[model samples]
Target: MSCCSPEGHCSSAETAAVPAPGTTTVYTVTGMTCGHCEKAVGTAVSALDGVTAVQVDVTAGLVTVVSTADPDDARVRDAVEDAGYELAGRATAAAH
Candidate 1:
């Protein structure tokens, strides 16, 4: 069986290394349906100031960011929007 959909969207599991000196924040995003989407969002978010790493889970609509400090929500939102996706805000227990 293939991990990708007929439309070319892959849901294979991915993992990111933990950053020892950074703060981790996970945000929910919408409209990421493929590897391209993941790369686009990851690139955008990774370019933000203080961002140390980014992990995008397309299947779960989650973007995990590691930064030197707590990142600004608005900046993250703008970056996601600029990448042609919608930021649904930070992931919370209710978002699960």
Candidate 2:
């Protein structure tokens, strides 16, 4: 699915480029229902150090994170929690 914010445009932190040696991870997030929820999750995660991009899929409860380094699981969990959602755990490496 497209990573836009449901406004037919690229979203905040959803288009940043990761530096070298970076990795992308898709974490399962629960309790997101709409664009605002998606923004909350994306903003929180995107604020982290080394985070380069964030794409939230409310329909699938997925948050794809790209960073200049491997993101720590605990930090991502905390970010999601701060966004008022639960991190269901890592889903997989981000696809593209």
Candidate 3:
């Protein structure tokens, strides 16, 4: 599924790259349904200090992120869970 907003813009859902010094990792996420879920997931992920950008696809049931700090799957998973969702699996970076 695509991640475009209503204003005719291509969404970052399928993939995204945060070019900050310490924010360049990707993760796979699960258990998202509507935009609210996406917002929750994004909020949880973005709260981390090193996290710079987050992309979520409710239809695809995935979440991708880029962070400056070392990949912290646990924290990421915890954040997702905190947002009332499940992580489904480990999040490995495609560029890590």
Candidate 4:
């Protein structure tokens, strides 16, 4: 197990590296300006059934969700909405 970086953001570095044992889905959310926004999004998504872990990056507007099972897109949309951000939709690529 790892610890959160000094950035104080919700990062999956604490979970494991890439190719972790689960279905990782990355979504793009808009209008998040700070770490609190990231936490809000992470909390909302983490409440979903089968969800195992969540990491939100406000700078990139990406929320990466790791779950034991696949999550419905509508549910994801609602979760992001509940966090006061619009789900721009699933991200095609987190890396540029």
Candidate 5:
């Protein structure tokens, strides 16, 4: 089976650059139903000052971010919202 939606949009894990020595955090997001959603969210988050990579799993509603430092949650949340999605906060242990 292809890792794509019915609309033919394929999900992707986009890396902005080689990840610098940094922290990785996963955040739960909602309303991401296809690759476009993935790209939108990824682009927004990747624009953050310290972000080095962004992996969006639409099927899982999870966005894994690698950054030079512990990212500000408020900034991440705003980025997601700007991308027209909701940041459901950081992923909990159970969400993994």
Candidate 6:
């Protein structure tokens, strides 16, 4: 069953079945000076294939993404780059 039903609600049956683990990835996004920058980073990351969700903390300069597909550092980096930001090294464990 799909993770979310057509109505955009998660069904009990779907919830009962353990979903694949989602990997948490963090990226140091540079050149983000304001909320817009954060939004841009989030939008770019969320647009990636297999990206389930994205959260950004501007103060921390951190961008986190949850995805079922194996987190590709290069892909994440590219996404940040495409958004006009520079991506630091691979995410840290604690951030994940």
TM-score of candidate 4 on Cα atoms, chains taken together: 0.76
Q: RMSD (Cα, Å) of candidate 6? A: 11.0
Model 5 Cα lDDT, one tens digit per residue, 1-96: 433777776755443443546798999999887777888899999999989888888888999899988999999999999999999999998886
| Models sorted by TM-score, best on top | 1, 5, 4, 2, 6, 3
Return whichever of 2 and 3 wins on TM-score: 2
Best by lDDT: 1
Show where candidate 3 strays beyond 4 Å: 1-23, 91-96
- Write one digit per residue (lDDT tens) for candidate 1, span 4-79: 5677666535546546668989999998877777878999999999999998988899999999999999999999
Query: lDDT tens digits, residues 1-96, model 3?
Result: 434457646433333444455545555566665666778788888898778788776766767676766667888889989998888764454422
Q: Estimate candidate 3's alpha-carbon lDDT, on a 0 to 1 scale.
A: 0.69
With candidate 5 superimposed using the best TM-score fit, by how many Å does residue 67's alpha carbon deviate from the native?
0.5
Best by TM-score: 1
Q: Candidate 4 local accuracy as lDDT? A: 0.75
| Candidate 5 Cα RMSD (Å) | 4.7
Tell me model 6's lDDT, rounded to 2 decimals: 0.71
lDDT of each: 0.86, 0.78, 0.69, 0.75, 0.85, 0.71
Work out how many backbone clashes candidate 1 has: 0
Per-residue alpha-carbon lDDT of model 6 for 1-96, expressed as tens digits? 333446665321111122345976667776765656766787898899988888777666778777986688899999999988899876577754
Clashes of 6: 0
Taking the tens digit of each residue's C-alpha lDDT, what string does model 2 give over 13-59?
A: 24233344458788888888766777788889999998988878777
Q: How high is the lDDT of residue 56 in model 5? A: 86
Question: How many angstroms is residue 83 displaced in model 5 relative to the true structure, after the best TM-score fit?
Answer: 0.5
Which portions of model 1 miss their true places by more than 4 Å? 1-20, 94-96
